[model samples]
Target: MMQQLFTNAKVFTGTGEDDFVSAFRIRDGVFDWVGDAADIDGQDAVDLGGRTVLPGLIDSHTHPALMAGTAAAAECFPPAVTSVDELVDVMRAHAATVTAEDAWILGRGFDDTKFPERRMPTAADLDRVSTDRPVLVWRCDAHSAVCNSKALEVAGITAATPDPVGARFERHSDGSPNGVLTEIAAVGDVAAFIPAPSRDEQIDALIALGDELASRGIVAVCDLLSSRLADPLTTFRAAAERGLRLRVALYPGWDPEQPLADLDDDDREGRIRIAGVKVVLDGAYSNRTAWVHEPYPDSCDHGLRLVADEDVRAAADWARRNGVQLAVHAMGDQALDRVVELFADEEPWLTGIPSVRIEHATIVSDEYVRRLRDARMSFGIATHTVFFFAEYDGYEKALRAEQVPDAYPIARLYAGVEALALSSDRPATAWSGADDVMLSVEAAVRRRTYNGIDFGPAAAITAAQALMLYTGRARMLSPLENVGEITAGFDASFAVLERDVFTVPAEEISEVRVAETWIRGERVFAR
Candidate 1:
């Protein structure tokens, strides 16, 4: 790339100190000079017209591979379809578009908690969409799904079928399958039967999604669980070969039943590389399946701890041998406690990066943070604000009154954890556009849910802190290198905003738009 100078703008360098700069010069896809415009010595520069610039954002934990694979599914997320009736209408409308009578009618992002009925959509409700063709709609968390009667039959699930270990097929009063599948095992049972899109189709979808991500000011992401597709690394690399620009670090899921493929040079080095393996330890909080220290209110259940300690150790061992990070999906306090205990005496990585990362660390306590820090192993956390922002109703019911204060305590985590990233577990979250960086920044600053439920400002963070979490702090958790800052010698990637996020009222942060997104000295997206 040729040398380029961008001037006349307020640049948030994400350096955490004296970060703002007025001008920067890029050469060969890396920043070479960053200082005041007057220091440019009369060099020709493209004036930004006083816009606000930020280092390219990084989403440390997301499922873009899942998003790409399910791009064709009908979107049933809320503020669009907030009722069972509305959900049915969406599936019905989508069904109309499928010319083949036998084609499956699929939908994603339905939150039963946000509905007026405040109940899960039943098989009968989805039957209204298509009694003949199979219909399956996933809950917003992606941990559960409710299918129509046809889908149930197609999956061969029945009253006699035993629930898989660590998963459940919710039943009716008569012991017949109610079409509700919980957790990965149950959801996968029906999902496996759905005809998967071809690899080429998935690559195309991925490239399209990459463009969409760039438009939102995100330049890199960790596909926390990339094995949702047939060949995640290859598929992502294929997309990259066809103009996909996002820097992706893929963590293919760890399954004992189906061992991950051995890594090669291609998998180990690239813009899209296999960073690690992920092992899910428990279910989500939204469905009250997260393994918690205490039972959920009005219930004797302490939720389910899906994986065995031995299995987690095995995953850690694998990661250790491979010299890659091991990401544990620990949503509840009990699960988080298990993580701290399991890795307390474990070996640390020779690499400077954290050896283990706790994903969705939903209910972190002061002691937990202390232990994680004191432990021999290096620890990182990739948590989300969108979870509470979109699924507050589910959390409202799942958490005790005392637990609310500590739930997703942003300020505490920022002050405590050395490696912390506020990410968007998109498509998994209840809200549409969950990956929008501005929305998450507003959530971290305001500490308010989508319905305006106040989680208290005591745990809130400043706008700069929020951006750092998404930028500089977030990059620490991912395998992507030379990103998340506008400092000299770093990748010349950043986003130009329409207004200064620091100057905006905290409540109005989400309204801040990305006017342009540049990557490697090239303007890839312009709004």
Candidate 2:
């Protein structure tokens, strides 16, 4: 059961340009053959001198155990702290190596709209980095957080507590408490008083973030939240008993004390499975709090709806009565018009489930893309055009210039969705190198933003439709069968590339690179 082949590469069989293959064959892990290498006759080949292969990229939304607890936090972002006095001197040099004098320094991406003090960093600016230890930071869209008066007095969050139903806090004018916590029920009530990493440090941060997402050629994901770990199915069965070869699916986050019949005796084969249920529903248009139908142009308000329409119709009636797939996290346009009117006549993909997705459908419109294409809904759109090149200047300062031509439109969702998927909601969009996938396929084929600014260039798209939203339309929203696509019976899983990101130069498609990655057929990663 072990044959190989590969030869003079090029491959890319996400079918286009006459099914581009230069040779292929794997055997043990699938994909058994695919054309020309002078009609193959050799055995165990492996030449690849031309390099290019493809399809072993699939992110479709991520959060590898919340970016592996941000490798012990403290990063504050943007050319490293663009103000508030370099974010209180990098949180007072990460609280002088935290030898626990009242622990909890944390910290994440930052970006108060590219700071320079454009605001947001209160709690009296993290009490100049230590009101006797307990800082926090977060906002590179982990939907906001600031903390520090010893973390709102150890999360008792005063100023007479209150303010919980769907999050708030940022007070201080006469009303007090200004530690700036905003969405996710006020950043999960100050991250439930911080401190949670054991279970062998969450399986050593999920095998070091699954070998840094298999060295960036990301073999598979869809984690969504995986119950922010504390036994996400025993931390993915101890990350596949420690070999952790990527391929995860997990969705877990609806919890009525872990219901859905406690994942009914789960243990879905090696690389992790529990694929269903994660619900946010609103918040994050670079902190203007995306629940938009219009307001935020410097504010009158029209954001923040952090779930509730009878709790997204009771999490779509428990994912259509426990068949699974729910997803949700809608990004604006009034939370994707109330999740396209609660799955406009639910289909739950004809009962095997995986389809009602919509996470970060960041501002879709044209009458909700014609009400999600006239509700023939089997919905799926896990989007994240690397937040259009990392937050298109905070969506041109909180949208409304005609909602900046429908924010992350991706060529009007590949001319109207049929299961789109692409992702990197990484450390909620700032674990640097803009969560690569060729920098979200060069911001979905150059709709540009890291300062060159051309945001919705008529919603540009086409580096083969942005690498089929991260390969073969991101395995049609993940129950991960034949794997993204290198063709012949699929799943030999690949990546190779060191150029030919579709004949280059769409601003050098994030400089291409990723020289080797394979998965089901082995070679985990190479450089």
Candidate 3:
């Protein structure tokens, strides 16, 4: 491969200030050399016009395939529909466009807390849209869904049906299914009835998602669950074969029935790899089912636990024995505590595995932080502060006055954990613009919600520190090698920005545009 030099750029090496490089040489898709312009010999050089350059951003935890699937779904989120009537109107319009063959009307990104009615839409509300066809609109969090009567009937859920082990179908006082499904089990039961997307459709969606991520300067992501594809590995392979742009480290969604075996096959190469198995130990905090230590304020119910402790232990043991990483989705304090204890106890058995990760450690107490730090376990934390920016109102309603201050304490986690990473839980939090790394970074730095509320201001960090979480620290947690830094041995992937993120006001970080995104010494996106 010919050597290409990038010069006249302000480069943040992602190390400390002393490692800053003004020029770098790329050969064979890896950084060949990096140094000040005076020391570097220019050859086949491309002047960057003095633009700012950083390592291509990585979303340590996101669902690209899943978010792409919603491309065709109707938007029922705020600013689109602030009232129940408006929501029904949007769905009604979407329902009218559906053909007889595609009978179900699907929608996503609805938040009842922002609704003027201050309640979840019921089957009766949706029946007004269509009584003949099934209608399913998922909450912004994706942890819950409100289905129409036809959808409930199609899913075979009725008052006579017992609630799933760890999920619930919210009902009226008369004991009839009220069309609100909470948690994955309940939502999955109803969602299972929806026709699965074709393989071609899945590939198309993934390709589009790749382009979208590339446009946003994202060169790689650790996709937590590729979603309910017929075969996630095959689907990703098909996308990669078609020249999907972004690098992906996939962790197939956890299934209790499946054995913990390594699925990293021949196709596991530079762009795609089965990194680990992702399991959700508890539901999200937005839905008030995050398995917290204390009950949610104004309610006697302490959140729900989706997976049993024994099952988590079994999965952890299996992953350890098989030499694969295990990533658990534990959001609540109680859930996080249980995971810490489990890892601490299993420390003796762990050997060759890279790292055991805890996703969305949202509510961490000082004690929990100390326990994780003191255990001396090989662990990683993948968290998102964007939730605080998008869902502060909902969090305020769900948590107590004291609990609100500790929510999404990114700085605290950064101080306590060694392998702390940041991510954008896109589509989960429906802000004006979702899945943007800058938005997440800004939220972490500003510690302010969209409504201008100061949410745990003390937990805020500097822009550079926030950027490190996405670049340097994030790489330590994932299976991706030779990436996430502008060093000589790292992959030749980086993003040129319109403005210096380090000099911009924290609130203006999201406004900083990406002038170009390059991967493997090749330009993938430019604007």
Candidate 4:
């Protein structure tokens, strides 16, 4: 007999096509049965008083440990800047305060695209701020970084150094490395010289971030990378051992074609799990780096591929044979085209066969949509522009101008494919909550926002369909069992919705709230 019997709860089982808006029974950490209220055992009832019950939501992407690091730096946030002069003034004030010999003049929240003229902060621009100290002013995208001449000299980068394959080093016409370093590889090159937080410091940050996410009703997260840190394996493990209550799925790092023989298996007793290898096929399109079928209309850039496909195939085949899951990061249509071709024609893999999730199917086109349906590949999307672009514009403009309709294509997904997986690529601006999620859903379904602004509203999906994406869709994307859904033998994880997400007004959906969350049939979060 189960210890908890939630009665009178409206269980949203399955998704749009197979949804059952009915009651369910939970016993011994698994769903015993589901039916009308009359079918439930009254003897051990814990009535929910007609609240909505949904499968515990899953975030298919995030960098959990890096978030922990950000949480650690919250108090040190460099304040906002009003004008160019004001920005310099603020940095000068902060730099003067640090007495340490090698102290960093760190500041976030400068968007090159936002200024009256979309110009990057030059080394000269930062030198005015603090000539005496090393200044590293990062762009909001985190892709582009502007460092003062002092910091640039310390990095040992100059005109002769060729750009890292997948990254861009903004250069002087004289071919010298400009202060701006774009993308992960270049950022890594410069950051590689910076000292990382020690084990104890990282552990402390992880615990703090875990508390933050838990407070936001996030029970599980899938991290992309740990940020400025190459050793991601130790990051998650430290969280588990040091009082992290949230479940973590780490999906990062890949040496293309490298065998996962040294891979770690899931540690269920602990909350953290190594989801699998992450492969970056192409850079994102905004940087004009997403691998594509045709060259950009106005740019000579045909996009860039990080690793050759045959090489990736060898790795995928090896992982499939060995029981490792390969999470490929593909953002451009052309890159996706190549990946689909490879997946369709590749030989059956061997072992670590987990779900082949396509990270950031950002430009999910019609041809790609059909291919996605045909291959039944697991996919995850982060429609975070709603929050990410609160201050900055041009995201939608760039997409529309380029004739890309699927900036957020949930409807096309449900219509053309079977599964819908969602993620909040955190540290993108904000973290989780019903408000943050509902806004994305509205963008997915209503195709519009508060002011009735429309980007690609035609691509919007239904609420029922969207709910499934956040719930059981993760399992569909992976070979994992009983993880996404609540079934007879599945892990018992659920969230109680205070209001029906399907019926709520688009903008008001966030107004509805999370009442409680259960992980393994035990109450872990109560709102």
lDDT of 3: 0.81
**Each model's C-alpha lDDT?**
0.89, 0.76, 0.81, 0.61
- Per-residue accuracy of model 3 over 1-527 as CA lDDT, tens digit each: 66788898899887753346799989988898998877665466788888899898888888776765555678776557777899899998998788858558998888787777888899999999999889999888888889999999999998889899899999999888999999888988998888776778888988988888887788889888764565666788789899786778877776777754554455345577777777789988877889888889889888989998788877776666655678899988888888887776456333432358999888887777788767756777899888878877678877787876677788788888867888887666656456778888889888888789899899999888888887887877787776679988788999999999888987799899888998888888999
Ranking by lDDT: 1, 3, 2, 4
Can you write out model 2's per-residue Cα lDDT over 54-147, one digit (the tens) per residue? 8787887877777565557887776566677787888889888878554688888877777756888888877887788778878877877788
- In model 1, what is the error at residue 391, expressed in angstroms? 1.1
* Model 1 alpha-carbon drift over 4 Å, by segment: none
lDDT of 2: 0.76
Q: What's the TM for model 4? A: 0.83
Sort all candidates by TM-score, best to worst. Answer: 1, 3, 4, 2
TM-score of each: 0.98, 0.35, 0.95, 0.83
Top candidate when judged by lDDT against the true structure: 1
Q: Report clashes for each candidate as comma-separated counts.
A: 0, 0, 0, 13
Model 3 regions more than 4 Å off: 17-19, 41-44, 68-71, 258-270, 348-354
Compute the lDDT for candidate 4.
0.61
Candidate 1 lDDT by residue in tens digits, 1-527: 58989999999998882479999999998999999988876778899999999999898889988987777789999879899999999999999997765568999999999899999998999999989989999999998999999999999999999999899999998999988899889989998888888888898999888889999899999998898887898889989999998899999888888776676666778798999999999999998999998899999999888899888888888788777889999999999999988887877974667999999999987888889888998999999888898899899999999998889998999999978999999889998899999999999999999989898568899899999998888877767888899989989999999888999998899999999999888899999
Error of 1 at 213 (Å): 0.6
> lDDT tens string, model 4, 190-231?
756655557777777777766555444456667765433446
lDDT score for residue 13 of model 4? 67
Candidate number achieving the greatest TM-score relative to the actual structure: 1
